[model samples]
Target: MFSSHSKLYRHASPGVQEELLALTSRLRSVITAQGVVRRTTAAIERSQWLAPAEWSALQLEAMRALALHAGRRVPYYREMFARLGIDPRRWRSLDDLTEIPVLTKDEVIAAGERLLAEGGPWLRFKGSTSGTTGRAMAGWRDRASIAFEQAFVERQARWAGYRRGERRAWLRGDPVVPSRQADGTLWRMNRAENMLMLSSYHLTPQNGAGYIEALEKFDPVMIQAYPSSVGYLARWLEEHDRNYRGKSLRGIVTSSETLGEAERRIIARRFGCPVFDWYGAFERVAAIGTCEHGHYHVMEDYGRVEFETNGDGTANLIATGFGNRVMPFLRYRADDRVVLADPGFACPCGRSFRVVERVLGRVDDAIRTPDGRHVVMLDWIFSGLFGLVEAQVVQERLDEVCIRIVAGPEFGHREEQALLLRARDRLGAQVIVRIERVAQIARTRNGKFRQIVSRLSGSNETDV
Candidate 1:
């Protein structure tokens, strides 16, 4: 298909595209059920493989090395260490870090300007995270950190049956650049026919149809995306046809949000693919990924995890990446909730990473009612309410929770009433529950949709 006189078209020949497509088809075939199961099982086996005494020693050594590195190179750490009158050389274990005091988001923000002014190390590249609260936080990382992050992701993919150089479509919130401007002609990432980049934000009814069309053309081996975006496309595909599985995708890898059972079933059924919900965050750098066995295994060798307790007895998860250098975060509170996996539980596969039952919710989501007499868990309210494709709980007034729901076609008066009954039972008789059918729910400026939102800025006076 290459024209003799044309230069760009030479690289875009039909034979080249066909060759890429054939290669991708082979890659997708490797993503088998047996592979996913082995990977999932391997996580537990790997963890169990670690001798307790050996693991503890390694963790302590890592912690000591990190503390010394931070104390010497990072200005903030140097100042903080001096303020605390601590000697970096004297610190030997992870427990010594507790004496350093916790660094809040405000402190990080204040120090950020100075950090940027310092221009960072030459080897480091700029990376920004929409921190736990969807607030912007900037940091720097070296090439090693980037490699480690890639390794963790690739390792998980391998476990899930994906091999290198496979063609997979990435559906992300961020749109790929060098996009087509003049016409409908789509540009593949690096002119690779097998890999297609689709925007998650533009997933409207019309755009979703277009997305399906693109998927048919790309014939990717796997579909990797956020659960919400995938759900939107999956539902659209199912509604459009009885058997709407895309031509290329054999499996789906979902991340960045809680994948409800209702969500998993819908996407799996609609796409005729297994949906594996991997858990990770920007703060922690893809720390954990779930296997087909539905167990979440931490990439333990990559990072150390710690559980902190609030006065209320709730557990908060903290992670420290041993890989990052430019801005090493040791025992950084990830602001996620998790419960430990059973100690003796072993998976048949042999890679060693600790497992987590599930990630409950974010730290800020649990709210204190107006009277201060009750605290409500957002997940409790959402427990069995996944029938609604999209939902948000808005606390604009005390004793009143405005529930905005985007209902599916199956949603009816009876479903609505059942939801109301559940809410009333949870919120109490005095609380007023308002239900509304809205075209769209308002997202935070950072483009994060909170399942539960509160306007109260630590103000409780509005409660009656």
Candidate 2:
């Protein structure tokens, strides 16, 4: 959901908000599962078993179709192809993509409507990405693309052994409860999907016991959560000498952030289940997920991934997506990094996808509030904002956080107030926030941007 809809939901009473949230999820399930989703998912499941060469042949065909469509229709790629003297008809292998320049996020922002197809690209819709950088980029998606993406998510769950209608818990960044909510009620049940939509923002060391108690009552078979959000609870369980008492829990699936090995061990130990880490981008240009064997495998059939190797053994991802023709990205450079497996390494699962040794970057520390809230996936606070170029949050004390921002020309007190209100919603109103305007926010030593940072010492993890 976009931030605009979040603002509207914020206006409703908490009781009405829960109903609205469930209604929205129900409606989306109907639309996304309509026609093409099931068929596509079955086809992908079959393709995963094909030989390596056969998989490559399938990807080459999809790349040909998407590239041809872009060249003949989209104004941006049409002009680019014309200037470069390239013929879409003769596009043969994955190597042909190198002829066109690798597109960057800045280029996509500047190109605007030129990136949009002229006509007949069919069923286009707008989408925005507020990733770990805290920068929002607007793009488009088609109906067919949305279905394909949903199929990919379902496939990952299948890999984790989640059957249809199985009870699960969602511990993501969605504000399921109001900020001022007391009484230790942090979750609302979605009977339609058999899901417990838990508020990730309200998780703190103080009232966190209630979360585990509620989960034991629900006894969900699967728990899908963010690494940071669930890690807090996992550590709390260990420190308190309490194991996760959900008798039906079979496994844990984590996504939207990097999973540290230490956190993975603790989570697996506390919950008595394997942790499956999933990696994907908002651009739909790349994907990586763990199999039943706990091995990371890049979903080669989902997208074509090329890598630029760094001196430190990590490789930057360069991708071309098969889905989302409304916003087809050819040779788009996603700054995310990963390490690849050694040659001849293959999974015992018998899938043809490439093995990934490790996924790097995308690690944001949880913003711990004085009230015990461990705030994760802070990209929501930066979504759908205007006149903000870049922003970063730094926590140096238990009760204070500094928000450094590169303000645009239209940024003023109104924008600043909105930000302050958003922070209060997650971190609690009592936490002090000092907004600082700067020309730029410094990147990491690897030229990576981190939006949510924590500087509190001895507060990283528990000693259970």
Candidate 3:
């Protein structure tokens, strides 16, 4: 279980703050000593060396068990199977799963009450999405599912060379400090997690040095943050002719936002450490993490992922989670696009799991064509072109889009025509695509760079 400082601590006196910190540290130590961490570590050690066939067998067995439980215990799935004329008990292999219909976020939002099992041995908690796609939805997760998710995260941390109980710093969306507090401490100590929770909203140019100083004093062995948050600091240091290298940092782990090649290089150079990118969603349907060799490998045991080919060499990801039996997500559509690599491709890290070529942003990042098609990854329009430092695609309306670019010396009319032609070819001839050259693209309030911003607000009716 996770622990947080009480609200009373916010109003406590200076002496009480220290006392609270001490109490938090003690609580964290107790939680760490519990069997959760130990079991997770053991699972990671065993699964990493499993042969390909052995891993597949284990996953299939888990899938069959989950399907049986859902059909027997869960109200929604039991009724769904009956309505679709499917018998979960008769399912012999993974291929038989196609008889069931896919689940969507809209269905989860509309019929969540029917999704939960009547009673179980596990405890349940309510969780909400970040609403980055403009639609916020809530779901439930059982304690066992939560523990397993934490284990997978711990396994990823180990891949990044971080050990449990080591000091670390976090720069994410958590509001550790009040946004209005302009002059005081911008961070709080989560002594239980041994974490220095830094505020992502306070990373301004004037406060960059203060943040750097605090991190240096804390001497955290690893920093887990959003790519945009760390990228901002890296840019600030470069502009000021300063550096934060030669510290206690072992590696930097990034998530939440897409990490670009340029931003990765900048962060690695300034921090003197490798940057590992992790991709996952709150729905817990699928997860992909960067390996030591910088290739993304799907955690095959965590979830089952199926790709829906889009004929453009990209596919939408549909996943079924092995965890979270409280709200079983069967053939859930994630709406995220990815390019899958050959199944025979093997990582030098000796893992036999499948690899993903790239995660092309989310479906919400797509521009809608007049014929009702969503054109995703329009940023590729500027790919391989010189003199383009950064680009953003804004879909303000159904028929029009604005391409914002931060161009360098070599950018010219020829490059502009190329971008326009590429967009037009994907969006069709009637759509109006315009290019707007700018000094720099803007980031979100949480310091995230969104490649595609769609102003349209409505339900996503795309088929899985």
Per-residue lDDT tens digits of candidate 3, residues 91-125? Answer: 76677888878888778767767888778854467
TM-score of 3: 0.74
Find the candidate with the highest TM-score and give its number.
2
- Answer with 2 or 3, whichever has the higher TM-score: 2
Candidate number with the higher lDDT (2 or 3): 2
**Candidate 2 TM-score, C-alpha based:** 0.93
Give the Cα error of residue 377 in candidate 3, in Å.
Answer: 20
In Å, residue 255's CA in model 1 sits off its true spot by 2.4
- Model 1 — TM-score against the truth? 0.62
Give the CA lDDT, 0 to 100, for residue 341 in model 1: 63
Model 1 / residue 245 / CA error / Å: 3.6
Give the candidates in order of lDDT, highest first.
Answer: 2, 3, 1
Better of 1 and 2 by TM-score: 2
